[model samples]
Target: MSPPTITENFVDFDIPQAGKPCKTWYTIYGDLGTSKYPPLVVLHGGPGMPCNYLKPYGQLASKSLIPVVLYDSIGCGNSTLLPEKRGDGTFFNIDLHMNELDNLLKGLGIEDEFNLLGHSYGALLGAWYAATRKPQGLRRLILQSGPASLPLWDEAQMDLRYQLPKELQDILDQHEASNTTDSPEYKEVVAEFTRRHVCRIEPAPKELQETFDAAARDPTVVLTMYGDHEFETNGTLRGWSSINELDKINIPTLIMNGRYDTAQDKVMKPFFDRIPRVRWIQFSESSHTAHLEIERERVMEVVIEFLTEDV
Candidate 1:
C-alpha cells in the first residue's frame, strides 16, 4: 500500500435530514490522468459512524485518472455538530440518512451522474438513493458487505451470533434479557462477534478501534430497528427489507462480498438473483473489507472490468 497524496482541501455544505438540517464535509482526490476516467463516489458505513477507518480507501487514486469523492455524512467524521439529538432510535433512521446522502451529492453537483459504491450501512443509503430518487447521470453501482433487508440482516446475524462459543452467547443473552444493552459483557460480546465476522483483520486498525470506542449508541436506532444483538431488529426498519425492490434498480450493479464476511453466503444470493442487471463476485480469501483486504491491484482490475463493461 502506497501513501496517499493529500491534494485537496475539505468542502463543506448542509443537507436536509428528516425533520432538521445537518452539515457535511467532503473532499475530492485524483490523479492527473483522472481527467478522462469516470467519476466514482465512495460511501462509508455506519448510519451513525465516521469515515476514518476507510481513509486508506483513497488508494483508488493510484489506479484511476478520474475524480473520486469521499465524505463524512452529517453525524460522522468531520461533519458538523450533531444535535443534542435524542437517539430515541429515530435519529439513525435510514430515510434521514438517505436524504442526507442525496442532498450531499446534489449540493456537490454530482447528482446528475456518477458511479456509486457503498460499504455496509452506506450500502443501504446508496441503494435508497439509486432506487428512490433515480438520480440522472448515474453510472454503475457497487455494494460491498451490505444487506438489502433488515429481516435478512437480522436473520443472518442470528445465525452468526450462535456460532460464538456457548459461554459468550449466554453472556449476551443475559445482557439483552436483563435490559443491560450497555453492559461491558454485552460490549465484549459485540466486539468478539465483530472481530470474528466483520473485518477479521488482526491487530485491528487504530482508526476503526477509535470509531468503535467512541461509538455513541443511538439505541433509538439500533434497538428500535436492528434489534439489540447480532439477531435483533426492533425499529421500523425491522421490515426495512429491499429484496423485492431489487428489480427497480435497472442500472448495472455489482454485488460483492468476502469469503469470511459476516453478511454470509445465503443472504447475498437473493440480491444477485433479484437485481435485473447484476453480477456476483466474492474474494476467495477475504472478509468484509475485501477492497482493503485483497491486493489493491487485483481489486481495481475487477472494479475496472465491471465499470467498463458497457462503457
Candidate 2:
C-alpha cells in the first residue's frame, strides 16, 4: 500500500551561507489543511545530518490534518553544497543557521509563522530560533531528544563512551590519542556503539538505515559538526551547551526522549524547570529517535494530541 503522505516539490532559491548567499532547495509535505492549522517546520539534527530520520515524520501528513515541511540546511542532504565555504564557512555556526531558516521561511512564504519540530541538534536549533529570533508566528514548539547545553551533550556522550566494553573503550581511547578515528577498527567500534543505544529496532528501519548509511559514506559534515563517534563532542561544537541559559525561551514547548537515549542527567528536568510552559514525554523504547523507535500509532498519538489539542 502507498504511504498517505502528500509531498510538495520545491525550487532552489538564494539562501545565505558563510556571509554570502547560495541556492538551496526545500520540500514540503502538504496535507488537507488551512492556514489555521500551522505548517510544522522540521529542523533536523547534526550540524550536517540531513532531514532523513525526519522522513518518517511525513507520516504526519497522512495522520494529522496539517501541513509539514522538511528541508535540508545549506550544504547537507538534498540542498545545494557549497564547497567554497567547505571548512571555514560561518554556515556551521548556529546564528547563521537560524538566519538561513529565517530567510528560507520568508522566501518560501512562511516567514514569522509555522510550528517547529526539531530533533537532536535541530532541537537546539529550534531553541535558538525561539529564544533569539522569537518568530512571532510559532504556535507551539516540539523538541525531541535535545540537549539544552553542549556540556550536557558532552556529559552524556562521556557516559556512553564508558558503557562500551573495556576493550572497545581501549580502542576508542587509542584513537582519540592518535587521531586515527578513520581506522577500520574504529568503524567497527562505531557500529557497535550505535547498535546498543542509538536505536532499539534491530537492523533499524530501511528509511532510518539509509540515513545512517549516507552518513557513513560522507561523514565529513557530521564529523565536522558533531565529531567522531556519537559518544563525544570534542569537535568544533565544544563549549556550546544551553541548559543553563534555556530560560530565555518564553514559548510553549514539548520535550521528548527515549528511555535508552544518550541525553543525560534527568535531561528533561532543566528544560521543564527553566521553561515555565513545558511538558516532557519519555518514549519507553526510543533512545534518540522516538518517531521511528516505537509503533506509528503510538508516535502519532502524542504528535496529534500535542499539535492539535487545546493549548
Candidate 3:
C-alpha cells in the first residue's frame, strides 16, 4: 500500500574518447542489500533511448520484493550526454555502451548475481553481453521485442513496409531515396508505421513519449549507432549479428514480442532456435512496447513468473 523505496545516484564512468570524466545515472527500487532476490537489471532500447519508458517495470520491486535496477545508458537520459559525439560512429558503437553497463553492474555491486531484461535495442545488447561475456552470475535473461541481428531486423521491417498501403509505401521510398528522412513528410509516414507496429496505443503513455522526446532532442546515439531510417541500417551497426554466439548463452532465457512488432517473429526466431535454453511468447494484442502500452499487467505477470520460478 505504500510507495516503494527509491534511491538515485551517479556512478563515475571514465570514457577514453571523451578524455574527461563521465557518469551513469541509476535508480533502484526496493532495497537491494536487504532483498532476498537478486536485482533485475533493466536495459532500455534506442542504443540512445533514456530509461524513462521502462520505469513502469520497477513495480517488480514493490510487488514481488525483487530489486529493480534502471539506468540511462551513457549518452542518454540523466547519464552524461555527448551531443558533440553526434555522427561519431567510432565512439558510439555497442562496445562503449556494453562497457558502461559492465561498469554500472560492478559499481552497483551486483555484477556477480543478477537478472537481465532488455527491450528492443536493449535486448540486442543483453543477448550480446550474455553470449560474449558469459557472466557466471547471470541468472535469467529476458529479450523483450528485440531482434537477434540488425540485418534480420531490417529485413523484417522491409517486409512490413511492403504490406503498407501503396501511397504510404511510395512516400517512404521517395523520401528515403532522396535522403530526406528528416522531412516532415517522411516523419509523418514513419509515424504511421510506428503507430501500427511500434505502439498501437493511441496517444502513447507519458513515459514512452518521454523516451521519444529525449531521442529526438539528441539523436547522437541512435543516428550514429542505428541511423536516421527506421527500416534500414546505414550506421555502425549495419551487419551486426549474434547468431553464432547465441549458443554460448547458457542461462535460461525468455524472449517476447508483439504480434505486430517491427521485430517480427522471424527476427526473434534465431534467439529461440539458437539459445540452448529459452522460451518465446508473442502478445497478440500488442506491438513493440507490449509492456507499457497494452499488455502491462500480463507482461508483468509473465516476467515475474519467469524471474521467480525455480529453474
lDDT of each: 0.69, 0.73, 0.90
Better structure of 1 and 2 per TM-score: 2
- lDDT by residue (51-93, candidate 1, tens digit) is 6666555666655444677777665556654545435455557
What clash count does candidate 2 reach?
A: 6
Error of 1 at 232 (Å): 1.9
Q: What's the CA error at residue 277 for candidate 2, in Å?
A: 0.2
Candidate 1 stretches greater than 4 Å from native: 1-21, 31-34, 88-92, 217-230, 294-297
Write the residue-wise lDDT of candidate 3 on 148-225 in tens digits. Answer: 999999999999999999999999889878888789998898889999999998898899999999988888888888
TM-score of each: 0.85, 0.89, 0.97
Rate residue 134 of model 1 by lDDT.
Answer: 77
Which 10 successive residues of model 3 have the least lDDT summed? Answer: 226-235
Candidate 1 lDDT at 218 equals: 30
List candidate 3 stretches off by more than 4 Å: none
Q: Kindly indicate the candidate among 1 and 3 with the higher TM-score.
A: 3
Q: What are the C-alpha RMSDs, in order, of all predicted structures?
A: 3.2, 2.6, 1.2
List model 2 lDDT by residue over 1-311, tens digit each. Answer: 34555555544455433445455556677652453577888898887777777887776766765678887786677676655554553456787678778877776777656789898888888987887777887888988877787777777777887988899999988986898988999878887777666777777878677766666655656666676555667566777766656787887898888877877545556777887789988877677776877655676788778988773
